[model samples]
Target: MAWLSQYQAIVYGNGANGPILQGGRSVTEQAIISSETRQAPQGKMSALALSALGIVFGDIGTSPLYTFKTVLGTAEMPSDPATVLGALSLVLWTLFVITTVKYVSFAMRVDNDGEGGILALMALLGVKKHHRPSIVAVGLFGAALIYGDGAITPAISVLSALEGVNMATPALQPYVVPAAVVILLALFAIQSRGTAEIGHFFGPIMLVWFVAMAVMGVAGIARHPMVFAALSPSYGLSYLFSHGMTGFLVLGAVFLCVTGAEALYADMGHFGSRPIKLAWFGIVFPSLILNYAGQAALVLEGAPTDGNIFFRLCPEPLLLPLIGLATIATIIASQSIITGAFSMTRQAIQLGWLPRLYIKQTSSEGYGQIYVGVVNWLLMIVTVGLTIVFGKSDNLAAAYGIAVSATMLMTSALLFIAMREIWGWSVWAAGFVAGCFLVVDSAFFLANLTKIAEGGYVPLVLALLIYGVMWIWHRGAAAVSQRMREALIPVDDFMKRTQAAGIPRVPGTAVFLTRAERDIPPVMVWHVKHNRALHEHLFVLRVEIRSVPWVFGEQRLTIEEVAPNFWRAEAHFGFMERPHIPELLAASKSLGCTVDLADVTYYVGHETVIHRDDGMGMPAWQEKFFAVMERNAVHVSDFFSLPNDQVVEIGRQIAI
Candidate 1:
């Protein structure tokens, strides 16, 4: 409650969640409030914009590789000037409305302390674990869908790029899938090394790739300027009316053009909104439009509809070189998704939605660069399996749009909540903005649902499994915390009783890591009760991870002396931070706490969970699963970066 009051004052300027404080004063009455106060670092705009091209645009940039080809082949309509023009029109407008206007112009403004994503949006709405179950479930499900996208994006991107080889010679078609598998395996294998060294080249390579796309598009456009007619919305609308169900079904393939739109918002923390927006309007957007237009022009110029349209647009002389570039572009796209998964996993762990895993910070300067072996290998296996199962990008495309469409819908819903809560928008204005996105996202989602029998069920199944895990973890953790809170004794009262009982005091300091800072940890009470002794200097340290990305040094630790030689220290960290107990203790000197880091012995509680048939809040099966997960989770010593030899774990059994 104390921390809640403090956080409220920091976030809302008054200790309340409402838009107005006492005395009839509006929260923003003093000055105009902007969407985001934290600007990107100064003097790095050019460099950051270029970097955004590589990281932020990779997924969407590479979409032109397979989008046109899949649309033409999947749609029941004949590949004529009308159909080609109609499809290209839909593609252009989808990019404009979804990526350019919605995400770039709107969602980027609603961030959690400069971090953007579905999870960040959820946090921005101030939803915590087991609170607002429906909203939290929506955010978690949306985040889970991204993992499904992460798995399928690499498979489809790499396979489609490799399929360009078959365009040169049908004889090499058999090797396409194997080549894609090899490339994907190699991509995942290098994830542990981090991308800091090789990341610099991503911008240059994407620039070259986009330039080539524009040039090739111009060459095709020069042959037939009539493709420009597709710019009109009439062709798209007329095409849909002319052909009833087939026209609507074509949207499933059309959705592929903006599959990576979410990445633009999700990666806003990495490159900032300005740089990402600049890169989008400057390079990525123009190139994609021209390339899609070029593909349409080629189709209208009497090119074969059965062959790959993207590859066929290129001149014969540069076909192999184009394939090489496409491969690199797809690999970069894959890397973006992998890195995103790592970042999301870390956020989930810090927010207590999931258990701790082994996280390695890949770069000291880049807080976004991280590697999680569990997520990496799991994604690799799923991606490779999809490559083998689908066998071609055409089939993988069926599984792709379903997850992204669902995620987009969820984002719109959360954004509606943010507009009302954070932006203090009226219900009517927020509904108008959210309603538009909902219409587009829901249309795409329904269109993709038609492809369920055609491999779209893959991501749905994967998302459900992930959602189940997250929900279980959240519920189990809350239940355990509740049981611990009920059993805990007040620190002051415990100290008084111990002193009155004349317990012997030991020599060195004993640091007990706990969750509830106001109370003596159950492990400490148990230890004192059994041994009838206490440390001369006892510290009950509780680490609280805030929703923001970084915490200042001056506000990192808050120390309070509860009694003589007894202190309760609350250490604050951000979701992006890793805890180093020794370093934190050394920094505690600023708070007037004289802590000997070398001489301190860490005490951590280990819970042995038991599942019973009693009327606890959870089912027996869920309790058993939670017990197993708790048993296998990473130890407190390693998670806190404490020395293993100096760490003592006291076990306690609890029923839930």
Candidate 2:
């Protein structure tokens, strides 16, 4: 989905600097501010922790429903206590090291102001394309892989949850795929309504899920007390060496346990680190450990390995209810993944890595609750298709951990840079600390790489496609920007020529939207040359999207008079803030340039790119791809929220 991958999407509330125009009236999104959830009052800590359970922990929280079973299935060895204990140990320590110690104890501390995630970290580290491009490409490729992860999450989660039904009764097996498709379709269908009204229930529902998992786990563990030996890291290490390649391959499956750990770091901005930590330590961590142990205990005590061992833990009387609960939990988990995709897409668009699209805000009271039809529908198609193709959670499991493993590996790399540059750590110190993570991440990535032929290519293929779009889009945009700069008009020279030519001034205010931040817009120069006239009050406006989440009102605009009745202006929006020219201009009124919004004429540049066959440019394939993307990108009028009726588009063609 262009919406999802290009979200590679950055999303945010437009602006209170100026409100968004719905049908006609001015409207500001009430609850989309990044800061609102960041600085909660002391009383809201418990509430935030509860909310964090829903948004941050959904993916990992639902892991128990499928993870332990999948791990056992992948190991494909006898279910003796020694093997069971070793697998359990690997799972427990993996949870502790990856989720608890690394993320909760460390990565959460590395925040961009208050936000987290790869992009936020990139912005904080100032990993610009010019300064360090390989690193930027790595960061972007990792971020793009997240979309691959996003695509698989819903399919695997929901499919696994519904598989519990087949666990209860084999006769109903034929219905699982269709039912999952229906559930996924419904989930995507309701995305446009936003999650504000129903989101509040997420935390409470997940809390119940954790409690249920813990209870069932305790019951299972009571049957085989010896299974608790998995707590020792020695057994996990022993398991890895004893089984040779099989143990190493098992690490890939074990990785599924903490695949969602990145979300804790990424979404730390939403609920803050403290609440997330509280939720993990207080509820999620214990629940997961207990549940995985429970599944292992059931197997150790002679439970069948083929049918769902997770459902085996539940008493026959309660099996149906457990199935329903697991299904609901999976849906919640899928929702979080989809919402994340939407958010990342908006970010990618704002940062110039993707073509701009019409981003629809779905909730006034929801946090980053927006929907892209393209992203939603495409994700739905893929998710449903995977359900049909893979057929069983076991088959889909082969595809699950690959993308997230690579993403985590990349995050570890970036974390090393942050330690060196941000924390001013010595290279050796950063290496030692990051090296431990690298061992785990690298092991898991390599292990998962073994599955590429077994459907792991699904996410990798999706990720590569998305990454290709990002790479091509960024390079093409740079070329276009360079071309415009090469052809720019010097303001002083233009002024002298205009005086000599005695150009006539038109009435009212005219706003020319430009890409140049410090140079004269070529579109304006082209306009004067052809039209041979200028507006009495003209503003050369350029919109700048900053590297942070929200750029506040006081710091949003800057204006300077370049010459008589002509102004050079820059409107700065955060990556999380949408750019609306009318509202941006309205904010300029506060800075001494007063103009009536109703009467102002907005002029924008329209580029028609022509691909070149020359050997000097990008490969011919890339040239064509970039041209197609540019041609299909959201028009300048809609991206900047200009008044369509009063807007004029001037066309220019360039070869890239």
Candidate 3:
């Protein structure tokens, strides 16, 4: 209730929408303010930062396992001290500029309410079905590309770690792929049980992993101290000019060091910006730099030129134990991306970009712990298939950076818009900042283009397919909403007309679920037109999803009497909250509505989509696609938590 008061002061105090209130304020303002307030205490901040090391840094943190090797093995680069040092310089600067400066300092600032991600950034820019549809498409495509990254990240990360086994024993080389497949399958299998159970161990384990990286890196540096020269930007610049096109191509591999940079922004909602930043600056960044430097040090110290520099840095006796640790770390890395996919899918459903899936909240305390069976299993199949097809981390690496680069490019564009609109920066100022990121992102994207024939086409094709689905669903939903609006009758006029017609009033209460709060539901009209009967007590209810994470019960529903024995109620819920019809009706009793759960009948509209070629806006193919998606979408009754037995569906056909 006190939170609602704060919400009212911040959201509605500007006379935006006055006191006829449900949830005293807007959810967006509450989320933003609370996110700020949450960062005040030092102890809590440290704990969150430590926790973030496991979840937020897993993808990037595990990069040292393969990044240096991949870069050194790139066809353009010869195995020499100068080339290796140049690649190391690029890796260091890429991590610092892209991960630390771009994401931690800039992109994270452009959150939607308190949430961050490409989609959330689009929401912050006020992208809608009608307004800036192009921007919406871009944002959706960026999100889709992340799923592609999600599939490849686990495959490559686990495979690369498992490959360390081959270094330990030549006899175990045949078992690497099989072993990786097993580990990946087991990881996906346990996803249903939720991460909360094992999450506590993740932080401590990652802490040890980082400490080990620092120690190994220091040991390697002791053998060849000259590798520290790679810290200078001049080495990278000199290599680029000296090698010309060959150096440029090597950037594709160099880009791998920052492939997981988007995860920092995507997972910001789970861990606040401060904590993520702290984790990056405090532990993750230093360990990554040291480990990468160490790998370069080993290469310069005349280690074998076979591209297994990571394991080669270890003493022969510790190699197997190191492989075990690396495998566990990589598994943790895979879990981060899989969990990120689940979170992004939930966000898409809440924002109406995608249809509802059966989302299971796996934890009672953390709203972020969710499981989607479709996403989980689909990722498993694709990841395993990729491992089988690519057969090695080196081959999977080619498919990796393209999606990440494209996503970063989109984020840069969106961040430019946010700077002007949300942060009130001048166009010149915004463009300058965004221009720098655009240059970096575009270079990486173009560099990775040469990899298409090798394996990079995978994520691009996957992104486009997903983009088509989201685009069709968005357009189709708009068309349906438009048709419904065209057929809608004003509630006041409908009430007056029905009363004058002298229709017989039935005994039980009938609740009509509506899209618009002030308009009569089309389903209610159809029910009255055919059945020729009206309930004695009628309620028109609309459920509104707010931009916040939670809403207090006292401010959850607003009820008003529209006519004799008729009422209108608006039930408000945060995007993170689930809606339950019976519970809402019970809460409405406090607002002077007398309702019995057992005697209530709920009315809902079900549309059958028909494809038309007469330029009703959508193409015939897209209309068909939309129809298929609509047919499979989770039913409104199920989404709203209404009992199946108490619900009556009214069917209608709409052509688009």
Candidate 2 deviant stretches above 4 angstroms: 1-33, 594-598, 613-615
The residue pairs found clashing in candidate 3 are: none
lDDT of each: 0.80, 0.80, 0.80
Model 2 accuracy (lDDT, Cα): 0.80
Worst 10 residues of 2 by lDDT: 6-15
Model 1: per-residue Cα lDDT over 1-656, one tens digit each? 34322211222100011111112211122111112213434555665677677777889999998888888886665577788888889899999989988899899999876778898888777775436877888989999999999999999999889899887887999999999999999999998777767776777888999999999999888878999999998998888778788888888999999999998888776556887888898888999989999889888888887867899889888999999999999999889888888878878887788777777655433334467888899999999999999998988888989999999999999989988988999999999999999998998999999999999999899999888888888889878777888888887688789989999888888999988756888889888877798888888899987776556646778897787777789987666556667767777777877655557999899989886457856898888888887887778787777878898888888778
RMSD of 3: 5.9
Superposed by TM-score, candidate 2 places the C-alpha of residue 129 at a distance from the truth, in angstroms, of 7.8
Q: Which window of 10 residues has the lowest lDDT sum in candidate 3?
A: 11-20
Error of 1 at 302 (Å): 1.0
Candidate 2 lDDT by residue in tens digits, 1-656: 33221111112211112122233222124224345456656676776787778788899999887787777777757486777888899999999999998888878989877778887787777854348886777778888888888888998898888888776788898999999999999999988776766776788999999999999999999998888888889988998898888898999889999989989988876667888898999999999999999999999999888878888999999999999999999998999988888778878888788887666765443335577667778888888899899988889889999999998888889899989988999999999999999998999999999999999999989988988899899999888888788787778888888889999988888888887776578888878888999888888988877777666656778898887778889877767666767767777877887555557888888888777667566777887889899888878888777778988888888777
Query: Which residue pairs of candidate 1 clash?
Result: none
Minimal lDDT window, size 10, model 1: 13-22
Superposed model 1: Cα runs more than 4 Å off: 1-43, 553-555
Give TM per candidate: 0.92, 0.94, 0.91
